[model samples]
Target: MIKESTASAFLFHVDGDGVCRTALVWHPRLEEWLPAGGHIEADEGAAEAAVREVREETGFDAELLPGPSLALPAGFPHTAPVAPWWVVEMDACADNHTREPHRHIDHVFVARVHERGADEGAVHEVRWFTEQEASEAEGLAEDSRLQLKALFAMISDGSLTVAA
Candidate 1:
């Protein structure tokens, strides 16, 4: 199958009411709600591409959390995984964006939004949804819901934490 590679970052933040929410972008071509992400540019790693995509799509600086470390023999070497949150292979229609039938190998990362403008409208068209809300939200991709569920589990199990 013809496949394209891309990277995405899930930006999570705690609202004033202390609710955990994630930022999603409306993908016009796909007509679905997705995280801030896009094609990985040349000379970019998956993690780096993810961060850049999030910034471009959401206008928020996102800091990605590291994934698991590599375990190699004393003399052997391996490049550890960069974006540890999630990685998925999914199918997509060739739309105006790509202009050809293709699939996407998505590299997903968990990140926290650092800076947002005072004027909410200034940010790109984005929506913030709580875990429960995301689960029931329409127009959301199945992968998105599954990832959100996993994220909630990670938080509940103390694997992820929001900084004050």
Candidate 2:
């Protein structure tokens, strides 16, 4: 099967009540709640795609919280882009037989929503979910649910910061 590159951002924000919440969009084609993300465009890298997807889909300006970078020698002639939290390959259309079978190499990122854009019109209905709410949410993919659980646990342990 052919493989296409994609980027996904798990965008989170801390509510006024000191609760961490993540945004999810209902994917009509997949019939599941998913993060705001899409294919990586030809002109951009995965990190750039992740941020752009979040803005276009959810009308939120997000800053990616990249994983730790390796220390390079001072004379290294390259600059490394922000690293994704995780990467996985999944079937793009597992149940849809009409389309050709393809796989997605998804770069998963964790980001914080800095602020909502002036134009709050999103492509899909956006819903915020607390940890408990997300755990109990129906139509959520198991992989996504596991990621959310880890994110919430990190936040609770002060390992992840959601402050703007």
Candidate 3:
């Protein structure tokens, strides 16, 4: 039996000038809009992959919000451990391209960017949507919808602030 492949992904919600919106990409296979994320590559950690995936999909550099970390002992390499803010267990079936059905154990993260734009790495068109717009958007993935709610909550609580 094949085990679910581990993946890392993140969504960026930027708030500048009283506007709140999230970055989304069009999924050609699914024929719908989805968040910026993808499979984790070999030789990459979850957190690293999350950051890399977002940059590749959305063309914006992302940094995970800092969290409590263990203190390194004496003589340690002095590297801080980065952990994912959330983990989602989801199954992604075969699309138009891939025939085999499989599941992805997704390591999810959220980030803030000064601006939203596309770059050469963008395979599909990237768009930003407000919380209400995203929630009402047609053809959005169910998982993505749920995650958006949480992101808006963070924004409401002021834990995640959009800088000018």
Better of 1 and 3 by TM-score: 1
TM-scores for candidates 1 onward, in order: 0.83, 0.91, 0.80
lDDT string for model 2 (9-114, tens) is 9989886667778998788888889988888989999999999998888888889998656777889999888899889998887534326778899999999976
Please list the residue runs of candidate 1 whose C-alpha ends up more than 4 Å from where it truly belongs after superposition: 69-81, 115-124
What is the per-residue lDDT of model 3 for residues 57-142, given as tens digits with 9 covering 90 to 100?
A: 77777767643345678898757647666676776787433467766777777666765654557766778888898889998887
Clashing pairs in 1: none
- Clashes in model 3: which pairs? none
Compute the lDDT for candidate 3: 0.70
lDDT by residue (38-124, candidate 1, tens digit) is 887778888889888877788777888775555566876666556556667887777655877789888888888754444243235
lDDT winner between candidates 1 and 2: 2
RMSD in angstroms, candidate 2?
2.5
**Residue 124, model 1: Cα distance from true site in angstroms:** 4.4
Candidate 1 versus truth, CA RMSD in Å, comes to 2.8
| Alpha-carbon lDDT of model 2 | 0.86
In model 3, state the lDDT of residue 128: 83
